[model samples]
Structures are given as C-alpha cells and as structure tokens.
Target: MKGLPAGLPSLREVLSRHGLDARKSLGQHFLLDPVLLGRIVAQAGDLDGRHVVEVGPGPGGLTRALLATSAETVTAIEIDSRAVLAIEELRQAVNGAEGDRLRLIEDDAMRLDLASLVPEPRQIVANLPYNVGTPLLIGWLRQAASWERLTLMFQMEVAERIAAAPGADAYGRLAVLAQWTCRADLLMRIPPGAFLPPPKVFSAVVGLIPHPVQPPPDLFRSMERLTAAAFGQRRKMLRGSLKSVGGEALLDRAGIDPQRRAETLSVEEFDRLAQLL
Candidate 1:
C-alpha cells in the first residue's frame, strides 16, 4: 500500500514515461488534474463494495481516483491498446487491496454488452471519450434496470441536454428518454484546460440514478420514433414533423396540442404520446 495519500505521480509524468500521447482519432483527452479526478469519483458516492465500469480510461487518471475510493472492483473498458498498457502501470501504483481490485478490459466500449459484464450493485463512473458518449449512454439506458447508478462526464452541451426539462432549448429526445427512466443531475463543470490536450468544449459530470421501475414496455421505442420525427425538423410543428406516425391526429389522441414544438414537450407528454401510438 502507498499509504493514505496514495503518492501517485502526476499524469503528465506517467504519460511521458509510458510514451503515451492522446490520439485525436480516438477522441482521447487525458484528464491530468488530481483534484478534478477525485471530484469525479466522489460524485459516484459510497462505492465501497460496489463494482464500477469505466469507459475510455485513457492514461488512467480517473482510474487511479476510482481505486482510491471504497469500490470493491473496477472494470475499465479501454479501446486503445496503448491505454491498456498505461492502465496496467496505474494498477501497480495503487498496490495492495486496491491494486488487486482492478480489471482492465481492452475493447471498444460501444461493442461491449455492459449489462452482462458486471453483476448487480454496479455503477458506471467515467470521463468518457466524446465521440461515443451519447450512443454508449443510450445502450446503457436500454438496460437501465441492471445497473445502480451512472456518474459520467460529457461535453457541457450534452450534459445539459440529458438534464434538460420541458420547454428548454436543450430538451429533446435525450431529455425525454433520460428523464423518463432516471433521475439526472449535473454534478460539476470542468474547464477544457483541465485535460491533457484540452478539448475545445467544456465538460461536466452528470449523475443518473436509474428508476427502480421502468415505464411501459414500449415507451422507449415510441419516444425514439416520436423524437426522431419531431426534432428531425425542429422548426416544424409536431403536426407536420410527426405526420409519418399520425401527425396531428396522434397528438389529439394523446391529449397534446399538435401546434407544440418538440422542445416544449415534457417527458410525461412524450410518454403519453408514446403510449397512444
């Protein structure tokens, strides 16, 4: 054990020693600030005895913080081979109890069936690569019942969309789906400069606690179809945009005004439309 402080070296030093550099193609931006990394892990709350799944553990800055937490085990999915090797060094640095608790899986997070990878009482804590964050989130939301919590980082815009409510500019399909199934909150914002190769956009951590129970079985699919059409032509009214699915008639059936725009509709309103359709 490395004692109370953990005594880990700077992420820049680790990257330089390992000959690791961020790959733009992979959307890799290593988060090097220890204070920020610690904050991300703290957002997950009481990880002791809990299993955590992390995506894109580039250079393992966040991974090291997760290890310092009380988490029982950590399964980090890294797509880049270089990152896998770098994370191995992090595993060694943590040492004892914590070191033995880490597991690094070198694979594309998008392709992995996360619901099956870890058992129940699991939490997903990660500073995800920007390129695949949304798709990966939708995949996990499809299996929302299996996991306990999701403490994730995303571009500030995306985080806002996830936490957006009815009538907000950020509200749309993501808001509907995320709100329909989970309680989401914006935890904290991180400046771009905090990263190794600072991304152009600011990022924020969002926490999503899955609903203990799900909505109607077909609610997600319906909302998906509805939003795809509604937001596909955001400037158009719902009556015009949703014509393929029943248009004004569908809204009438669902008790929603056909003149409303997609961004103005609440999750409950979307759910009602989905149920009617």
Candidate 2:
C-alpha cells in the first residue's frame, strides 16, 4: 500500500529512534499503521488549500499522512515532549512547497487558545487522546464558525454519544449540543489493534459540519444547564428532575409533558426547555 513518503521515518522508526513508548497518563496510543493513517486522512475530504488543526499527534503517524495531503497548513498540537522531539525530523523534512506547513506546538490542546493558532477555514482532524477528546470537541463547537468540519476520532462510546439520536443509549449532553449546532455523522469504526499499545475499546471517527443556527449566548447557557439537570437524573421524569430549574412551571410553559423523561425529549424540545429556562 502507498504510505508516507520516503524522506521521513516511519512512525515505528520514529518511536524506536527516540526510545519512546506511549504514555498512559497522557492517553497516548500511537497509531503505527501508515495505511490506516492514509485512510483516516482520506475521511477528512479534499484538503487542498485548507488549514487543519490536529491534536495529540503521537509520533506523527496521522500527521505525516495529513502533511502528505494537499492541505495548505497543519497546526499540530501535542503535549508529550518526547513525541514533540520525535516530530522534529518530520518538521525539517517538510521543505519546498510544504514550507512552514507543519507547526508543532508542545502544549495542552485543552488550554490552547485555538483562535491564536487556527487560521480561518480550518478543519480539526485527529487521533485524539482518550482523556481530553470531549472537552476539546466542545471547545471547537463554541468556535465552530472558524472551522469548516470536525473529522475527529474518539472512543467508540464517546463517538456514539456525539452522533446518537434522542432515543439511543449513548445520547446525552454531548449529543444535544453536537446535533443542535452541527450536522454530525459517524464515519467509521476502527478496531483496537490498529495502534501501537492498543486501547481496550474500539475507536470511531465522527464528522461534524458546523451550522450557523446556534442559540443566542444566554440561551445556549440555559440549554447546557437544562441538559445537565435533565440528564443528571435521567431516569427521573422532567417535572421531578428539573425542579430547581422551574420544574413543572417550566414544563407547562414549554408545553412539554412533565412526565416525559429526559432521554425521550428531542433536540427541539431540549431547545424549548432551554429557551424557557
């Protein structure tokens, strides 16, 4: 199969040369298969002239694949010092037309001010660390206008939640927020053995197309609080669960049944509850 060009070291070679292993505390699971890496980039769609932001690029396996594409610039954020060192060669190898196309930052992606690094018309594509994936996604959702698409990988359960329907088992806080602000799709499921130190659960990639129809600022806050309350006590009926947030009166005002459980409420109903709150 075609893979990363001949100039840069293979991902396995980079790990070996640097004497590094995936760090569990950092949620590191290095993807060693370049073929899989190519496939993952392919899922990001045509990258020609588009800027991409990648998080947790361990050993640059997926990073190499992304750079191989036509993407104009790729800002890769990584937390591991050893892994950052490992990417130095890859960075130097990117010369000529790919000049400065790869910006490797050693920092926590969760804390990074995304606007500072990400240029307009960006897409987030990553083999995201299991620990901070959801928070990172939520942060991106808040700045969704700056991004074109979010083709992100997450634990299968988390991916399920992001793309889940109101009645599905995985649907909850993340789902409501994701579906409300973006059109989400579950692209594919990946087996555990694809990575160096394979994760226990399978992983999945989800693509989110951002929409401009988000709730107004205060209403968005209300939606978050309302989802937290409803799903916080999911088994309880809306009237009992939402007591602190106006409970039955809020339910009456929204014209939603007080007896309906949180899990059963559609995104529109959730929005109504948020608006009423």
Candidate 3:
C-alpha cells in the first residue's frame, strides 16, 4: 500500500502521466490527499462484503480507497472520458484481482438509474461533483430505500443544509427531507488545500443513514410539493408561500401558523402540511 501494486504507478504519477488536470467546468477538484480519502471511507463504517457505488470518481482517488475496503463490489460512475481512462490504469495498477470488485461506468451520474445499476446492500460513497451534488441528493432521497447508507462530500454550505435542523440558518427543504428520512450528520470539514486544483470554498463530509421507519410514500411526495411551494418563497410567510399550493386554510388544518416562514417549520409540520396536499 505504501506504493501501488508492483508495476502500477502512484495516483499522482498516473495523473501526471496522463496529463490530466482538474476541470473547472465539471466542478472538478481532485482529492489527492490519501489521508483525507481514507477518512471519508472510514466514516461509512464497515464496507467488508458490502456493495459500494461511487459517483464522479475523478482520477480514482476515493475509488481506490473504496476498493481497498474489501467490499464485494465497487462501481464508479464517471462522466469524464479522461477520468475513465485514468481509472482504468488504476484498476490494472492496484491489483488485477481488484478489477473483479471494481467497475467503471462511463456516463453522467445524473442520468443513471442508480438503484438498479449497482447491486443491492450498497453504500454510496463519493466526493460528488460540486455542480450536481444537491440535485443528485434529492434523487437519492426519493428512493432512499435503495441505499443502506450514503457517505458523501459536498461544499460545506451544502453539507450544512443536509444535516441542519429546523430553525437553523441553513435549514430548508433539504434539511427537512434529510432529517426526517435519514439520520444525517456532519463527519468532518475538509479544507480547500486538500485537492489538486483546490476549490475556492471548503468542503465537508456528510453521513446519511436512512431511517428504518420511512414516512408514507404519499406523505413524502406531498412534502416535496409542499416544500417546493414553501421554500420557493422562503422569506415569505407560510400563508403567502402556501398560496400556490393551497394557502392559510390548508395551514390551519395542518395546525401550523400561517405567519411562520418555511425556515421555522419542523419536519413534522412540513409532513403535516404535505398531507394537506
């Protein structure tokens, strides 16, 4: 592990050989710090024999860490052609046997049917692309049952929103959904200096373990609509924001004050309002 398997070069060497540089357009910032990568993997708990799916594995940094975990399978989805080739070199470099557990998919993560693409009993671990992180999160939440856990990296602000509680400055739709459906927590803060083309902002790793008792599917769908309406005008009163959906009368039935803003509503109130939709 000190160096790569026999003939395989180190990750840094591989990237250098391929002339790969992090792309700003893709929101790419390669996490080259091995220590940090290992820490992200450790936060997901035991991966032994578990299936793992990683998205946006730029140059196979975190993907390599995941493969080392002895997981039954490690699938990496990448949209960058250069990264796809780079990861291929990694599979051959690390271990031929690792290729048995490692898989590389050349496609955009946003376009994949994530649930069916990978084997079940899977934990999604990735340093997600900054561009599509939030939308991808919402997609996963809609089908939270498919994943056993999600250990993801995001801009610190986005991570804060995921683990934030009601009434907090960062709390909103993402908070309500993440909190209600998953036991969300912030594991650690990662500094910009950790990456190759270091991003301007800091990043954080967040762990989300789906709650055993999920909300009603109908209620979940309702919450989506309610949250959309409410947070679409987050600064406005619930009465004003809810108007597009129903208005103060609906809020009255949910037993929530019309005067309250979306940021003030707890997960329970949001779910209750969702029921009205």
Candidate 4:
C-alpha cells in the first residue's frame, strides 16, 4: 500500500523507524487508525479559528489529524523526546500555511497551566495517557471555563463514567464533577485493534463542552469534599458516610434522605448538600 508522505511517515512506519515501541510505563498505546482519529477531531464541533491543545501526541497520529482540521493553531504537549522528533515531520508537512501554526511543546502536560499558555477560545483534543488521564481531567474541569471544548479519548470504562447519569451504576464522583460543570457525551468507541501495541481494554472518544454558568465556586469545592467522603464508604448510607462532614443534620438540611446511598444522589442534590455544609 501507500505511505502517509515522503517525510511524514505512517504510524506503523514511525513506530518501526524510531524504535518508538509503546512503553507501558508511560501509558503509551499509539493509535494508528486514521478514520478514528478523524472522527475524534470532527467531534470537537468546529475547530476553525480555535486553538487546539493536545496531550501525549504519540508519534503524531492524532496530531496529524488535528492539523488537517480547521483549527487555527495546534499546540501539542508531549513529554516523550522520541515523539517530539517524530512530530517534526508533521510540522514540515503542514508547510508554511498550516504547518507554521503547529507548536510542539516538549513538556509534561500535568505541569502546564493551559489557560495561560494558549489564548482564549481553546479546545483540547487528545488521546490522553491512561495513568494521568483522570487527574489531568479533574484539573482541567476545575478550570472548565478556560476552554471552549474538550475532545478526549479514554478507556471505555472511564468514558462511561464521565457520561453516566445520576441513577446509573457508572454514576459516581466523576459523573458528578464532570456533569456539574460541563455537558458531556460519549462520541464513539474505538476498538483495541486500532492502536499499535493495542491496549487490553476498548477505548472511546468523549466530548465535553463547558457549561456557561458554573455552580457557586465554594459549593464546587464543598461538593468535591462531600462526595469524596460519601463515596469513600460508598456502601454505607449517607447519614453514616457523611458524618465526618456534618452528619445527618447536613443531609437533613439539604432535604436529602439520610438513608439514601451516595450513588443514588443527583448532581443538583450534591450541590444542595454542599450549600448546606
């Protein structure tokens, strides 16, 4: 078959050429499927004139697709030096027009302050490293208003949790936090075979558009603490589990039944409880 381009190699060729083997330690599972990558980029709605931030651009697979989109600029953050070298060709392929728009930052995404780095109207499009995905996502959600949207790929289980409804079994701390500040949905599922050194579990792409209005600032923090305590002992009733915060009185004040389990509560209920606390 044909290759990607003369300098810009296909995912397989890049992996073979650079000894860029997937490192389990880095949560590196390189996605090689162009179709799936294109779908993920498209789900970001309209990237035109928007600044796109991508994390862990492993071998520039998703990066290439992002560059091909309508985004005004694509700033890719990658910690792996090897991947940095691979993306150079991607930068070249774009040439002056779109290519000049690509900025490859060799740094740990966890340490970067996204809001300060990229100008307003930013959207993050990434196939995140599994090890840091949840923590990174939580950090971003804490500052949800900074970005226009987020198009991310995560393990299917994680994606389900992000898009889970109040009463569903998948609903928990993630669902509460994600939904409280953003409108989230599972866009599509990508099979294990789509990746080089495919992960054992299936993965899915999720889209999150930040809510225009966020919950009260203090209430957001309080809700996080409350949920952490309540779900820490998830099997117990809220009355028992929440005693560390304000006991049954808090639940009573929120008009929530103390007998209800944490998993059964809605995001609004959590917000009310936080307000009461």
Among all candidates shown, the one with the greatest lDDT: 4
lDDT of 3 by residue, 70-158 (tens): 68887889998888898887766554644456778899989898889777788899999899999999889888888899999999999
Clashes of 4: 0
Tens digit of per-residue lDDT, candidate 4, span 138-203: 889988989899999999999999999877888899999999899999999988988888889999
Put down candidate 2 lDDT per residue, 1-277, tens digits, no spaces. Answer: 1123466666678898887798889888888787888898899899988888899888888888898888888888988888888776777677443568888888898888776786777888998999888889888777666678889999999999999998889889999988888999999899999877989999999999988766666777788789889999999999999998999999999999999999888998898888778
Instruction: State TM-scores per candidate.
Output: 0.93, 0.95, 0.94, 0.94
Question: Cα lDDT for residue 157, model 4?
Answer: 92
Candidate 4 vs. true structure, TM-score: 0.94
Which should have the higher TM-score, number 1 or number 4?
4
Model 1 off-target regions past 4 Å? 1-9, 92-100
lDDT of 1 by residue, 1-277 (tens): 3222356667787788777788888878888877878988999998888989999988888887887777888888988887788887766655554455788888898888987887778999988888888998988888788889999999999999999878888988888888888999999999999887899999999999999987655777877888899888989989999999999889988888888888888787887888888
Which regions of candidate 2 deviate over 4 angstroms? Answer: 1-5
In candidate 1, clashing pairs total 0
Better of 2 and 3 by TM-score: 2
- Report each candidate's C-alpha RMSD, comma-separated, in the order given: 2.0, 2.2, 2.1, 2.9
